[model samples]
Target: MLKFQEESLRQSVNGALALRHQINPFLDAIFEKGITNICFLGIGGTYASAMQTVSHMKEFTSMEVFAENAAEYITTGNRRIMDGTLLIYSSVTGSTPEIVKAVEKAHAAHATILAFLDNPNPHLRELCELCISYPQNEQLKLFMAADRILFLRHEFDCYDDCYENFDCYLADALISVEQSSDSFAQEFAKKHCNDTLHYFVGAGNQWGSTYSYGMCYWEEMHWMATKTVSSGEFFHGTLEIISRDTPVTLFISEDASRPLSLRVAAFLPKICANYTIIDAADYPLIGIKPQYRGFISHLVTHAVTNRIDVHLEAINCHPMEIRRYYRCLEY
Candidate 1:
């Protein structure tokens, strides 16, 4: 049972990475037009992926990036959907109704549709200008999406060595995988499972990190009540939730988001005995050898995020089929 679960996890990672491989060239072609603006239409894993893309594209390219939430896109006004925009649509199964509608809107406007699809969903392909297959998960498919960012932002040849070791690294993501280090998280989860509220703390881009791990995974694995507010956000209003009755998990990024993640980490230990703090520096599961540590960290974090996603689907009837639903809803 565990082995099957592990394969399921690795397959999700491998499947998403494969989609990135196909999407890169198409993205290159669209960017070649030197379009001034970029728009991403998505939610959940797709939204998370779009955020990473938005962050990276800003640092490396001059394009103005905007991400429209899927809900808004489903009901947006025609003029509100601008022209000359590069619409990057992400639907893991290629069948989100809102995304499909967004794609149609972009089509009517003559916008370029660069999609990340995991399967051969014909309707999505028919709607898009370039429909490339890439798996972005429903809740926490950030790891695979992070790699798609790296592929677009950095030198591919430099990181080509990275994919070679992915199978081995992913194997470790399962309990038998090398860096499971399951004790701390398992014990911490046990003590706080019944606790109704929890806070996820992280600094830098680590906000995304903890958001994926603490909120996404907890929601999947144990159906734990999780709120994914950043450290800064945590200190804002919800910090009142920090108490003996409410446990917290602090997810910090090493070089960035640190000052805030650490600051929040320091504050929570004082109020909550059930508090558990995990510094990203001490965790190697987030480390993907043969690549830059930052890239590896994002990829490893993504794998764990995806794993929790698989575990959740297994326990529930929530099959990952965003594409299938869209076909029914659209036509």
Candidate 2:
């Protein structure tokens, strides 16, 4: 009774859309409580949480806001927190050593600590004044992390125009992707013959799309060295290394992202041994326009890579022998 095509689509889109509803209320609560100069820290997939926070908050306040590797803050000691700084963390498991240590340090320094943890992990509770737990599954944790951004943006109370514009972005991203599972991995791998490196690039609020599994998936699953950079950097400098033997996967979306996608698409033939351009121009998410078709395409790309990992594992081919990567995550 379950169709593979429809089933696959549902899986991907639901995975993408679920986060908004789950995370928004928690973050909106934080924003309403009046925290200024917020910094978020996390590891791995949790990193996306910080990205989502920055994307929404950037519109509301420019007050020295950014997210960085947690370790970066840990080394500086109390100096990391100014009079107004409030630190929040997202660690799905409530554990990732560096993040845990950093949260402890922030609390010791008298910085307010808020944590979005995956469970009622005792370590997380001890280190923060506020510990918020969500469903612990990989997909749902992402939902909570993402929705926090929308809530935070609303709390910051941007000017009417800025708030409206970001809301549109949040709406499109949340509504557009539906759960689906069409594996495009074989199609991606089929293009590689002698083996080659790939670079994924994106900019603006969507730039995090480049590194989402692009670099890590290649190294962990495919045993390839993939590099991800911004479109401008790839054009100005990295383009020199690109040639007929190099492979490039270009993501083109509709939202304020067309020119760069087109530029890369136009230059593909001259610079690569192989090139694939995904047209995210007409994806059927209710909140997104056709230009943002790239989201569904991005899902397909990630699915394909994981599928190929499964095949490689079946054949005993992965160099790292990364058996089901998550199961191998060292914590």
Best by TM-score: 1
* Steric clash pairs (candidate 1): 19-134, 95-323, 117-134, 143-302, 172-177, 203-257, 204-257
The runs of at least 3 residues in candidate 1 whose Cα sits more than 4 Å from the true structure, single-residue gaps closed, are 1-21, 56-62, 76-81, 134-179, 209-223, 285-291, 296-298, 302-331
Model 1 lDDT tens row, 83-196:
567677667666666677777777887776766677858987886777655444432233334344445655344435665565446445433421353344344434554556
lDDT of 2 by residue, 1-331 (tens): 1122544444544443454453455555655776656676766555654654555456445455667567766776547464446676667666577787777777776776667676768977987766766553333343234335444555433223332333455333432232222234344554552355677765434455456556545655566667877665668887888878667777665545457767877877876856776545534445433432332343333333445445444344445445465556664
lDDT of each: 0.57, 0.55
TM per candidate comes to 0.72, 0.69
lDDT (C-alpha) at residue 328 in model 1: 57
Off by over 4 Å in 2: 1-29, 59-63, 77-83, 135-183, 193-196, 286-331
